[model samples]
Target: MTQKISPNNYLITVANDRYANSTQLFRAAAMIHEVIHAYYHSVVDDNNSPTTNLSLNNFPALYQAYAQKTYPYGVTVAQHDQMATDYVVSMAMALQEYYYNNNPTPYPFLSYEVFTDLA
Candidate 1:
């Protein structure tokens, strides 16, 4: 969840208590999901206005952009849709990089299959 305290500050929270038992990859992905929600909060509702700021006329270049599409579905649905489509690869890449960086080892076949405990 996201809470905006000011123009430039936002509180983005992920439930560690709820997700601590999950795999590292899943926990990492959950963080990316929450961060994207903060992005949505900033881009779509920074001012807390009742009307959407993400329109073709007002924000033409951003209207259909990957992280900025909120047309027929409004802000809520569109944010999730955009995140699901655009950030899945991001989540996987981040998790993969994390595995490689901390372990300092190449993926056996460049796949998570190399991590036995990832299950």
Candidate 2:
């Protein structure tokens, strides 16, 4: 089950496996991905634009939009968010390795610079 937590400002998705049957590390990994998504959303934009709403097609536009915004230091939050997504994708890969016996990984299509890296 995947859910949105408004006050905390992130979404959490749970795999359909029994917790006891799963490796604790993978469970933690899933939580890490959720945390990354929340953090990415919170830091990149102050306004909750519909673009920030999570979807496969809208992710790239959202990332580019945030990356182009002007802030105090001239550093875009989009860069930082992309880094967070990269880290999450790496984590998700490890988790998928454990779950699927090293056969595949998650979000394998997107690059490290794009938030789609973990989408």
Candidate 3:
């Protein structure tokens, strides 16, 4: 969520409390979701009248296909549906890399199947 700080500025804050005691996997997923939100905001947010493109909010090619498929009325799904379908393996791999970096002895490998059940 966003809080309007002033006419020319906005503040977006992630509540780390939400991830307190959460596993690294979930933490990574949350981070990815927020990142997608940030990207969407960057692309579409234009003053008070946000502009969406023919490419489904002008999302890059990587996101355009699935976004066009799932965007309601060619608007947006808040990028969640596309994120779910496209970034699962990425999130899992990120988690694995993070764990390995923290503890190299125990390779924390995971398959994309770990996230297939989500959504």
User: Considering every candidate listed, which one attains the maximal TM-score?
Assistant: 1
Global lDDT of each candidate: 0.61, 0.51, 0.57
lDDT by residue (1-119, candidate 1, tens digit) is 77777654788777778887886666666676777778766664443444655334434235446334435656567777776677666666776776667554464445754332231
Task: Return the TM-score for each candidate structure.
Answer: 0.57, 0.36, 0.52
Best by lDDT: 1
Error of 1 at 78 (Å): 1.2
CA RMSD per model (angstroms): 6.8, 12.9, 7.0
lDDT of 3 by residue, 53-86 (tens): 3444334553556556667445356366556677
Report the lDDT of model 2 for residue 115: 28
User: Model 3 — which ten-residue stretch has the worst lDDT?
Assistant: 44-53
Give the better candidate number (1 or 2) by TM-score. 1
Model 3 misplaced stretches (Cα beyond 4 Å)? 1-12, 46-78, 107-112, 115-119
TM-score, ranked from best to worst: 1, 3, 2
